[model samples]
Target: MIFLRYILLPIVPIYYLVTWLRNILYDFGIKKSVSYNFPVICVGNLSVGGTGKTPMIEYLINLLKDDYLVATLSRGYKRKTEGFQLANIDATAESIGDEPYQFYNKFKNDILVAVDANRNNGIKQLQLIDKQPDVILLDDAFQHRKVKAGFNILLTTYNNPYFKDIVLPTGNLREPRSGAKRANIIIVTKCPKDLSEAEKNSILKQVDPETNQHVFFSSISYSNSVISSEATKAVEDLEDFTLVTGIANASPLVHFLGDKGLKFEHLNFKDHHDFSKQDIIELNKRALIVTTEKDFMRLKQYESLKDKLFYLPINVVINDEVRINKLIKDFLKIKL
Candidate 1:
């Protein structure tokens, strides 16, 4: 794969030219970039997928939901529908995409959640609702140059930092490393709990964060045990269960389970993999099938295996709470 990437280096110029032109068009007003009246916090990454944007968005929602009317907007990736659609009581994982649907179901009463391919149109639709939200959170939209955001939080996985990676066709970066300058705050997601200050300093040296930009580290926290679908038999005693996950980053989950003294046979798959009937049959061969909450959203459609399947929900916890809280307060105080 390294040799193949080098062979494909010639296309890098073309990619740069195309991105430059698109940015130029928006910069010179040749193309319009729209902004909503509400304060928007954009959680995104320079890579294509799996930077833990969804969990980070959820973290922000949990932090700000009490003081502000929070709304979430996503591009509705891989959904069956199109255009701006407000999530209703009947919204399913298939209708508004798995991530947004999960948010809607979890925070149904307190928050407003919608999905749209066009960010501006989605914000407009949300504004037309009975009670407009004070703050809107845009999920996975760093590269959406057509919509201007008030604050951009760029996330790069700790294992695969963008500073060390090259562009697409050569590396996993969606844009050049310099593109990181656009981010107001940088977060090293999916880091280990024991990552030392010296190691963090080295990473900051590589990232070369500007004086104005704040940097923070975070790790994933999995809930205790898997919740059964029947809501009766709690699988807290997990001595005979198999772990099955289809996320871009499963190492953290695996490590967390190990530290808990829970033994599990893991079946890992590529990110965003659509589970099939045969997959469910093979998974059921174990005593129980365990998975992440994100994967559970996709797997729940398998009515045949609903009784046997269980999920372990996860949350994001910032390592440096003091610095994170201060930065958030400063940002919130700014008049956009």
Candidate 2:
């Protein structure tokens, strides 16, 4: 696959030109973008996937849910259903997608979670609700120019920043590196726990943020315990188990477990991969199974796997937490 992308490298210029022009059209107002009175914060990335979007979206939810009525809008990637859908009792990973379903299960009472491929129409449907949200967070719509987000919180992985990458087929980026200029805030996600000031400055130099953009660095804070519907167990207490993951990147989780001296065999799959019957049969052979919160949403559907299947939940731990919080809070306050 790595060789395949290089083989397709000639197309990069074509892909680059096309995406560039589309963004230019939106940027220069040749294409009209809808704006809302309430703050619309978009959390997205230039890369194709695994830049910690879900964790960042959850971070925003936790940050704003206490003070404002917050609603999240996402494209509901890989779900079976179509059109706008507000999470309800019947919601499932198959219905509204894994990440949104996770949001509904965890923070249903605190925030409203909705999914629609058509974000403009999604916002319209959300507006029609009895108590419209005071703020709407678009999960992954930096490229979705139909609705102009008031504050764009763009993310790039610390390991593979967009500036260091090329556009799709040849590399991971979904758009040209110049597209990052659209961001109000640029975050280097999945960084080292003890990221130093010198290192931050070095990364910032490479990212080359625009004059108005504020750059932040963050790492994943994994939970100490693994959760399942039946029970929970201390991560350290787990014996030999299979690490079943269907996420874009599993290296961080693998490294985390390794650092803890946990022993396990990994059964990796593509991101958002739906399990086949044979896949389940292979997974069921293991006595204990651990997965990500997103994969757990789909994997637990098998009754035979429910008792033993567990998932580790994680949060984005931003560096310089106080300053970052103040900056965002001030932006929201002034915007409102």
The TM-score leader among the candidates is 2
lDDT (tens digit, per residue) of candidate 1 on 1-336:
889989999998788677767777877889987865558888999886588998999998888899889999998877888899889987877789888988997898989989999888888898899899888999998888788887889999999999888778777888777778878889999888789999999998998998888899998877765775665344457776788888887887888778778777999988867677788788767777888787787787777768878888778989877787667656766733
What's the CA error at residue 273 for candidate 1, in Å? 1.9
- Scanning candidate 1 in windows of ten residues, the lowest lDDT window is 227-236
**Where does model 1 exceed 4 Å of error?**
1-6, 28-30, 232-236, 259-261
Candidate 1 local distance difference test against the native:
0.83
Q: Best candidate, lDDT-wise?
A: 2
Clashing residue pairs in candidate 1 are none
lDDT of each: 0.83, 0.92
**Alpha-carbon deviation at 153 in model 2, angstroms:** 0.4
Residue 155 error, candidate 1, Å: 0.3
Candidate 1, residue 269: CA error in Å? 2.7
Q: Tell me each candidate's RMSD, in Å, in order.
A: 2.3, 1.1
Query: Can you tell me which runs of candidate 2 are displaced by over 4 Å?
Result: none
